[model samples]
Target chain A: MSEVQLTSDLIQWKDGAADWEEAIRVSAAPLLQQGNIAESYIDAMVENIRTLGPYILIAPNVALPHARPEMGVSEAGIALTVFNEDVAFPAGHDNKTQTARIFICLAAVDSDSHLSLLQGISQWIDNSELLNRLLEASSKDEVKDLINQYS
Target chain B: MKILCVCGMGFGSSLMLKMTADKVIKKKGLKATVEATDIGTAGSTPVDLILTNNEFASQLKGGKSEVRAVVNVASEEEVEKAINDFLESQ
Candidate 1:
């Protein structure tokens, strides 16, 4: 076990997700297993996109999966799931479904706990080189190293 | 001045935008307060300006506050430009 304590099992790599909803579920799996979030939290993440549109698509090929803090979050936790292929998310711009290879699922306990993490994540999203490398990275450890370097 | 950062869920991505906006607003020495908010509750709250991504910008338009659709919420440069534009227009 290489340091799987607080931030353990928080980063993962996947071949692809069936759809946007599945992408969030896959991204949030680590958090749920680590007791950071409940089942309803995952549903809220999906429902949020469906109702509010793909506002989660913060960057070009990245989606920030999150919901209301009171949805079902035990504590503030973050998870990053990278997909080799694009996962289809609904209406990003001009009614066109946006697909992102990176899904950063977030479980925020309150309004402020996750701001620092988001700052790192959003800045990481701005790094095109890192994002490109993440899309091609082979192992979860490799991806974890890159994410840790930034966040 | 009061600024509201909008996202799907107020606490989700808006907080990040709020951080960037706060930095830029402070660096520019402007008198403004940035608050993070979700899209559902953002409409009723009147502020001087609203900073949000392209997705939520349209949804927040036509309010008392001006709306700027920021493409990159993490980029302080982009946010700084928006704030300067706001000041220039005022």
Candidate 2:
């Protein structure tokens, strides 16, 4: 299996955003600074949610927001931001919403580049104990440790 | 069997689901080909099964292929069970 590393610089901790769009923008900001993605990628991510709803909510309290590689990706990278308060994303056709505290923004250069990272994330999400630890992680090192241990 | 795993944009959650589904298929010793695509193009793709979240699955109801709504895309157990159940029915 291919391995992907999670660096501390790509992780952020914030009180919370007023809404999911803001949350996604905040999460993708680090990647933008690193030149891994362009501003359009961020807009594409939010646009995806607006049109398709929050299918990005892979699990309760966890969301992986991303758009197509051709949208605006400069390279393959991943960034994560954890909010102290929950943010809501559109849920179903009836206008319901799902709450998420952890947002992992992904920027892949191609369809297959992020598969390994996605697999690692899937394993982490399936482990409730680890998921709770991630939600409670206060420091970047704490979050990095958890990701290293699991991913 | 051919399976298409879908999400809003096809790069994130659906890719994750594809990984999980691939693992399940291998562990179960099932012969299947799985691919990931966005919701916009998922309907046009010809596949035997479509695996996605409940919201998208609902929209795919009455389609040609079987649609399986995975409650937790990251849970290998849930993905495995859904695929196994679908296979058993066939």
Highest DockQ model number: 2
Which candidate number maximizes lDDT? 2
Clashing pairs in 2: none
Off by over 4 Å in 1: A1-8
Scored by TM-score, the top model is: 2
Model 1, residue B60: displacement in angstroms?
A: 1.8
- Candidate 1 similarity to native, TM-score: 0.89
Expressed as tens digits, the lDDT of each residue in A73-92 for candidate 2 is 98888888889899987667
Can you tell me the DockQ of model 2?
A: 0.67
How well is each residue in B1-90 modelled by candidate 2, as lDDT tens digits?
A: 999998887778887888889889999898999998888899988788999987799888678889898867878898988898788889
Model 2 residue B71 lDDT score: 66
